[model samples]
Target: MDKIQHRTIFVNGINMHVAEAGAGPAVLFLHGFPELWYSWRHQMLALSSRGYRAIAPDLRGYGDTDAPPSSASYSAVHIVGDLVALLDALGLDRIFLVGHDWGAVIAWYLCLLRPDRIRALVNMSVVFHPRNPSRKPLESLRAAFGHDYYICRFQEPGEAEEEFARAGTARIIAKFLTSRRPGPLCVPKEVGFGGSPHTQIVLPSWLSEEDINYYATKFDQKGFTGGLNYYRAIDLTWELTAPWTGMQIKVPVKFIVGDEDLTYTTPGIKEYIHGGGFKRNVPFLQELVVMEGVGHFLNQEKPEETSAHIYDFIQRF
Candidate 1:
């Protein structure tokens, strides 16, 4: 961890903070909501030791990166643009992409918009959701999961931020990182994200107090608005991505997910993943591994296995 280097570079009109290690083929890691480059600490060290350059950014609106004020600034196009410019600035023409949660969602768009810049991809948690020509993303999600669903709950700016503030940054970080529940996360307006002041959250063995503090300190400074903006722009992203409605992900890919991941259990998701729908859309998908009993935070909870899964599939190309 001490060996990893950090730097700030101007990209896509924002000063972006990036953490990097090793010096071989670049493997770009993108993190999910409420996460930072630190989320990939173990994988960065593991991959770096194996002679692969590991790069994880704080992303446009998270950590040390500049957070543009408007929700419109966080669309997939904007995030992907930041990455393309980062690659150009670093003199990297192509990279091995790895993403989890929202990061996986961005990786899918990266492959969709600029296949030439990616050598291959290793994605976790979220799967590629093909565009729906008939409806917007939030609408579909609200209809399927109801208004209390987390994504729906995140649509309104300042609403979730207030709940997060009331919950305390450290407690919120602990709740997300240590969560092992497989059901859809729904925070009702009345119940709030704080979930009763009396409810106690126990940290898992994989997550330490230091880790919680690291994330808490950042969120305390930056607030949750920037991270939540990604959700806010979902409908706009859907509007802008119409051209990619039925297109297949063209890069060689390997996907892994915890059997207990909420994404894995989402209605119709199992069918999409195994009912030939996923394969049909991702024709170049090379492998799929389901780790039993694992949860959404697979990279952090199962670092060694996650790193091995990444190294094994990426080394083949």
Candidate 2:
């Protein structure tokens, strides 16, 4: 980690903090919610040592990046614009891109919007879902998972933040990072995101107290609203991206996921992935890996294997 270099770059109206290591072909990493550039620390270090430059940015509304006041500001178009701008600012034309969770969603959109700017992509956890032009994203999610589903629950402004506040920042961070529970995460109003202040979340062997502290410290200062805003803007993103409906991602892709991941366990997702729907949407898809027994945070949960998988794929390019 000491080998990594940090800097701030002004991109797409926000000051994005980027962490970089090594000095070869750039491999950019985009992290998901409740995480920071720190989420890619292991990958950054491993890749750097193996002769690839690793870049991980705290995306807009997370970590040190500027948080716009409106959820509408977080549309996939806006976030992808930020990445394109970041690449330009750093003079990178196209690079191998890696994304997880929300980052994976954004990466899919980025490729859809501007494939010329990406060499290839390795997306984790989330698979690209072709846009349903007729229905808003929130509506579909509400119908499928019900209102209590985490994404649906995060739609209302200030609601999730309030529960996060009451639950305590670090506790909530620990809860999210350590959760191995499969299926859709539905936080019923009665239970809250923080199950109980007294509930002790046993840290997984892969995640250290130091890692949780690194994330909690940042969220403690930045607040969860910026990250939650991603969810809050789902409908807007859906509407804005209506034109790209049915557009297939052309870039070569390698999709990896933990079999135990909530997204993986969600009803019909397995069918979607293995049932040929995923490949239909991601036409250039090269490989699909389902890591056994791993959970959503597969990269962090199994850094060595994850990093090796990453190295093997991107090195070919």
Candidate 3:
């Protein structure tokens, strides 16, 4: 891990923290919620050893990066703008993009907003949610999953943060990182973000105590507000992304998801992926792999397979 290089570069009006290694073709990684560039540590080292320059950023609101106070600042446009400027600052014209969870959402938007800058993409966990012109994202999620749903529960400001604080930062991080349930995560007002406090959580083999400490120490300093703000801006991103309605993700792509991943088990998601909808939208999609028994944090849970999957796909382009 000490072999990885860290630097903060000014981009898009904010100071962005980036971790990079190797000296060949660039591969840019985008991490999801409750995570930082540190989440991509294994991939950075693995891919770098394979002669690919791997770059992962702390993004705008996580880790050492600047977190703006306004929810408006966390929109897709703002996050993508930060990345576009980061690429220019690094003197790169194009890169192989990879993302997981919310990072995957941003990857889709990046492809939509700046396809020219991406050589290819390997997105995990979340699929491209084509914009629905008739409804806002929060409204749709509420109607489909109700107020207790995690995303819906996150809509209100400070409520989730208070719950996280009550749960304790390290415990909360452990719960999210070790969770293996395939069902949609619902944090009811009564249950809160940490779920039942009496319920014990067992750390999985893939995640070590040290790993939790690394993430917890950062979340401890930065607080959950910076990360939760991403969920807060979903509807606003929907409204701002109207121009991308019905647009196809034109880049060559590969998508992989754990069969037990929450997004995979969401209602109708199987149909969407296997029933021609996904292919129709992402015309250039090269492959889709569903790893059995793996959960939401696929990369962390199965680092070797995940890194190999990324290396195999990106090397083709």
Candidate 4:
């Protein structure tokens, strides 16, 4: 971990914190919610050792990066702008792009908006669905799942933050990191988000207490509001992305998802992936891997396999 180099680069009006390792072809990593560049530690070291420059940024509103006060500022355009600016600042024209969860979401948008900037893509956890002209994303989610569904639950500002406060930062981090449930995460008002103290979350073989503490300490300082703001701005992304409606992701791509991930088990996702719709949208999609028993945090839970998949795919380009 000490081998990793840290630096801050000014990008798109925010000072972005970036962790880098190695010194060859650059591989940019984008992390999901409740996570930072630290989540990519293993992959960074592995890729760096293999003679590639691995760069992971904390992104706006997380870790050492600046968190703008408004959810409106957390829109996809803003995040993608930050990344593009970061790439330009680093003096890179094209490079391998890797993303997990929300990072995956932005990666797709990056590919859509600026394919010339990406050599290839290996995206995990989240699949890119083009903008729906007729309906907003949050509306679809609310209709399919319910008001209590996690994303919908996150729509209300400060409510979930209060729950995380009650649950305690470390405990909530442990719970989210250790969770294996493969369905829509719902938190009703009566039920709330806090878990019992007796219900200890056993860390998986891949995650250590030190890892959780590192994440916990950061979240302890930065708070989850910056992360939650990503969810809070979903509908705005939907509205702002109308110009991109029906546009396909036109980059060589490999997508992987854990079978037990709620995203994988979500109502229509299996059919979407297997049913050629995903391919029809992402015409250059070269591969798809569904690992059995894996959950949402596939990159963290199976760092070696995830890194190998990324290395194998991006190396081909």
Candidate 5:
């Protein structure tokens, strides 16, 4: 395998720490919330060894990257702009894009904002559904997802910021790093979010005390506020994409989700998604792969399967 190297790239006036390697085509990997570029360790090495240039960045407010304080700064348009600027900084006009969770959201928007800059896209976990301008504000969304409404709650500023600092951010970081598989308890049950009670869930076999400690230490450097800012962008995201509302994605795209992912089980979900949502969005969409035993954190839980699928997809392109 090719050795990975670390470097910081300045984009959008903020310096982002990137882990990259390989020598052929450029593939930028964008990580999800609560995770750093460290999450893509397997993909970086595997893709690099296969003669593909793989790059993973610690996004604007995560990891070793700069964390600006304004919620306005973290909106989809701005985040997407950051990616474009990153490409400019790297002297690349276009590249393959892969994103997970919040990264996926940004990936979807990036394709919408600047199709010329994206060669193809792979969005995992989070599906791209355009914003509903007619929909009610946060409360309606909260009602839809319930206690799983943490993302909506995160819009409330100060709540997530103070909670992490006060409730031992270390434990919060440990909860995510130690989780091998997605559990029902990842969010609070009182809000009807998915997962069992905190005590009922079992830690994944893969997580070790040291792994948890490492993430916790990183979280200690910056509070959860910066991470939470991503959630504060709903309105801004909606307004920003107003022009692209019925537009279909022209780039080659795929959606990968785990069967056990709670997203599939949400009530009235299919209709909501299919009713002029994602299905109407990505026209050139290639495939949707639902792995049987995997959960939300598929990359971490089943790295071999995830990497194999990713490699297979890229080969076809």
Candidate 6:
């Protein structure tokens, strides 16, 4: 293991633990759910070797960061604001942003809310599925998917938090990190995309023995409350995003997803991506690339390819 120096910084009234290495152009790496700054271990070293200040942080409430107790504190607005304050704290004016899963959600919001502070954007495994202001309630979405939808289960207060807590973080992490081999070319009917429930499944290939333990240890320390707060804010997210309902991200944007990823296969998915909100909001968008034979955890599954695509995109600007 290459030893990397770690530090603690205060942002948005919370103490954030960040792992940093290399030095050059700024590339802020943000991890998704149940993951820590360690999620970008490879990318941080790779980019650092190539003259980039690669920084990854355990976003508020996930790792060493302070986990606020209220769901209201976890809004996308607040998350993005934290990122802004992070930059301010570091005295950085602009940066190349990279995020996955829930981190991608915050990345999208950050780019929208403060484009001037971001030099470029790269998202993996998650798409910019804007909040549907008039879409059916999360309950209706859950009822539609049933046991197949884990997200809807998450939306219900206390139920998911309690269930995941009882099951333990290791179980929850295993469920999402399932295998990537394209099996049957089918999307489970129960897990709807864009804030729908996810069917329980086995862990994916990307997670090795050490990876699992790493995540489990963090969950052991943080519990799932802070991470769950992101999901709990669905309704609040909708209400907050109402102001930017028609706002498209004008920054140079790129969305990457695995072909085997359940996200791209949801019914009416393409319409959602290419029509209405997306088209109107992202004016200077880049292409969406789908990697075959890969699952949702692309960075871990295929680091060389992920890094290549990201560097290529950043070089263009």
Best by lDDT: 1
Clashes per candidate, residues 3 or more apart or on different chains: 0, 0, 0, 0, 7, 11
Name the lDDT of candidate 1.
0.93
For all candidates in order, the CA lDDT equals 0.93, 0.92, 0.92, 0.91, 0.74, 0.76
Please give each candidate's TM-score. Answer: 0.99, 0.99, 0.99, 0.98, 0.88, 0.86
Model 3: ten consecutive residues of lowest lDDT: 179-188
* Full ranking by lDDT: 1, 3, 2, 4, 6, 5
lDDT, candidate 6, 1-317, per-residue tens: 36567888999899888888888788998898768888888888888877788889899878888899888899888888788888899889999999998888889899888989988899876667655666634655565656445565566566666666655566667655664433222224343221122445545455676787888888888788788888788667778778887677878888788877666655565566666545556666777778887777788788878888888888666
Candidate 5 residue lDDT tens string, 1-317: 23888888888888888888888889999988688787787888887788899999888888888999998888888888888898898888889888887888888888888999988888787777765667634656776666555676566688666656554665666555444333322355342322233544345765556656666677688666777888886677777778887776789987788766655445554555556456667878887777887766677777788877788788776
The TM-score of predicted model 5 comes to 0.88
Writing each residue's lDDT as its tens digit, candidate 1 over 1-317 gives: 89899999999899999999999999999999889999999999999999999999998889999999999999999999999999999999999999999999999999999999999999999999889899888888888889999999998878899899888999888888877666678778998876777989888788899999999999888888889999999898898898888899999999999999988987788889999989999999999999999999999999999999999999987
Off by over 4 Å in 1: none
- Worst ten in a row by lDDT for model 6: 188-197
What are the C-alpha RMSDs, in order, of all predicted structures? 0.8, 0.8, 0.8, 1.0, 3.3, 4.6
Error of 4 at 138 (Å): 1.4
Q: Which scores better on lDDT, 2 or 6?
A: 2
Task: Supply candidate 6's per-residue lDDT for 37.
Answer: 88
- Candidate 2, residue 137: the lDDT equals 85
Error of 2 at 272 (Å): 0.5
Better of 3 and 4 by TM-score: 3
In terms of lDDT, model 3 sits at 0.92
User: What value does the lDDT take at residue 35 in candidate 1?
Assistant: 96
- Between prediction 3 and prediction 6, the one with superior lDDT is 3
Off by over 4 Å in 5: 136-139, 146-148, 177-202, 270-277
